[model samples]
Target: MMQTRRKKLSEWVQQLYFIGPSLFFFSLIVLIPFVMGMYYAFTNWNGVSNEVTWVGLDNFVTIFTGDENFANSFGFTVRFTITAVVLTNAVGFGLALLLTRSIRTKNALRTIFFLPNVIGGLLLGFIWQFIFIKGFSAVGDATGIGFFNLPWLGDAQTGFWGIVIVSVWQGAGYLMVIYIAGLINIPSELMEAADIDGANFVQKLKNIIIPLIMPAVTVCLFLTISNSFKVFDVVYSLTRGGPYKSTEPVTMDIYFEAFTNNRMGLGAAKALIFFLIVAAITLIQVVITKRKEVQS
Candidate 1:
């Protein structure tokens, strides 16, 4: 019994050496802030004077009742999330399909496709902003393409699409890498059998490839949903939620409320609501996608 107790104590020490530090930091950085933010969500803390007063559900009531900007931002975020998620995954999956084929430039093309994702979102947005401002104008002047001459980020409609275009371009590459891994993991025998059975490319893709790659689909969808819903850096650097605040996301709204407007309590309330929305949406997406995932 003494030896067994000593062994168990040693094992627990080993486990603590591995898990204790991570748990400590996580609680410190994430859990503590989350709890504090939750407490502030029900108060009227301005973040400056520190006279935190409990206001019950006043912040939430104001958000749902009087905050038109937040509502508009919420609407914009949902629309952008849906659009970005679909386009990013579609482009990524297409790139993966093409790159997985037999071609001399396959490696080079894969690198090129994934190059955009390597750039940070803020930097990428700035780069695209310059391109939309100068590069597009120069190309339009040189090539006489009217489509390229339209104001990319100067108007509400164009600005929204401009953000979408940048987001899709930036995100597709990362998703392509995920898809490439999934594609390579598929067995050669199954594809060969499909070919021998006179299965056309489309038929095999519909019947075999898609179902088998559901794990990758789940991962990609979840990633896209969360990232798109929480997107802020790119919009900040690119548009700054500008042109009459039409492109503002909820994250930006939260930032402006807490820091810019100094409504810490309102911002905390918004942040909590935002977290719940994202968590619920991603949870639903995971459940739906996981259901489609197969054993293979």
Candidate 2:
């Protein structure tokens, strides 16, 4: 018994040796701040002063009753998330299908398509801002193209579509990689059998490919939903939630509330609420997609 106890203790020590550093950093960077943010959510701290007054649910109350901007931001976020998720996944799957074909330039094409995702969102936004403002106008003037001449980032409608285009361009490539992984793992014999059975491309895709790739679908949907919902850097650099705050997302709203307005406590409250909403939505999405997943 004594020997067994010593062995158990040694095993635990080994486990802790591997995990202790990660746990310590996680607590320092994430866990502690999260707990403190929760505490501050109930207070009336202005983010600068040391004086923090407890205000109970006043922050939440104000949000529910008087926070039109937050509500509008949230609504826009939902719309954006839906649109971005569908387009990103659709484009990604299409690219994956095209790239998986027996073509000489497939490898180079994959690299080119995925290159956009490597750039940072902030930098991409700024780059695209210049392109929309200057490059498009030059193209419009040179080619007499009305589409290129339209103000891509000057107004709310164009700004929304502009952000969407950038997001889809950046995200679709990463998702294509995931879908390609799923596609390559599918057994070749299955396709051969389907061909022997005289199954058309649409029939095989609907009955076999999609069902088998449901796991990748789940992952892609979860990523697109969460990323779209939490998008900030791109919007911050590109639109700045401008044109009378029409394209503002929930994250920008929270940022402005906390940092710009000096309402740290209120910002904390908003952050907590936003966290809960995002958590719930992602959870529900995962659950739904998980049910659709099939074992190949």
Candidate 3:
């Protein structure tokens, strides 16, 4: 018993030796910042001067009761999240289906498709901004087609669609890879059995493929939703929430509130509220997806 106890003690010591540095850094970086932010959320910190007074829940109350822009930003985020999530998943799943088939240059095509995701969001936004403003106008001037010449970043509706287009282009490839993994893991025998039973492609997809790939769908949906909700850099680079705050998502609103407006406490409150909303939505999605995964 003494020998076993000594061995266990030695193992624990070895484990601690391996984990101590990581734990120390994690506590210093993540835990410390998180605790500090939580405390600051309830304080009137200007983020510049060292004077921070505890304001209780005034920031939260102001945001919920007084801030019109906050409400608008939240609504815009919701709309963007829903649209982007659906479009990203649909395009991604379609690409996955196409890439999973026997093709001459499937690997090269996959690489090309995924290349956009490797590009930085800010860079991608700037590139797309030029495309929307200059390239579209040039095309319009040359061909007399109004479609390419539409005021993409000037109009609220057009700006919304422009953001959606850019987001889908960047996100679909990453989600496609996930869907491909899920697709490839599906039992070929099941597909063969479906084929033998005279189930067509659509039928097979609707029944077997989709049902079996619920986990991947769940992951993609969660990622796309969260990403769309928190999208800031791309929008900031592309439109800067222009056309009278029409394109402002929650993150941009929070950023502008905190940094530009010098309302760090209010920004922190917004951040906390945003975190809670995201957590609640994600938890609900996870519960539903987990239930589906189990049923499948």
What Cα-based lDDT does every candidate model obtain?
Answer: 0.95, 0.95, 0.93
Model 2: per-residue lDDT, tens digit, 230-277? 999999999999878999999999899989999999999999999999
Measured over all alpha carbons after superposition, the RMSD of each candidate to the real structure, in angstroms, is 1.1, 0.9, 1.4
Task: Say which prediction, candidate 1 or candidate 2, comes out ahead on TM-score.
Answer: 2
Show how many residue pairs clash in every candidate, following the order shown: 0, 0, 0
Model 3 lDDT tens row, 228-263: 888998999999998899999999998998899898
lDDT at position 157, candidate 2? 87
Off by over 4 Å in 2: none
Compared with the true structure, the alpha-carbon lDDT of candidate 3 equals 0.93
Per-model TM values vs. the true structure? 0.97, 0.98, 0.96
Model 1 CA deviation exceeding 4 Å by range: none
| lDDT of model 2 at position 127 | 98
Across 125-207, the per-residue lDDT of candidate 1 in tens digits comes to 99999999999999999999998999999999999999999999999999999999999999999999999999999999999
lDDT of 2 at 49: 98
Error of 3 at 238 (Å): 0.4
Once fitted onto the true fold, the runs of candidate 3 whose alpha carbons sit more than 4 angstroms away are 294-296
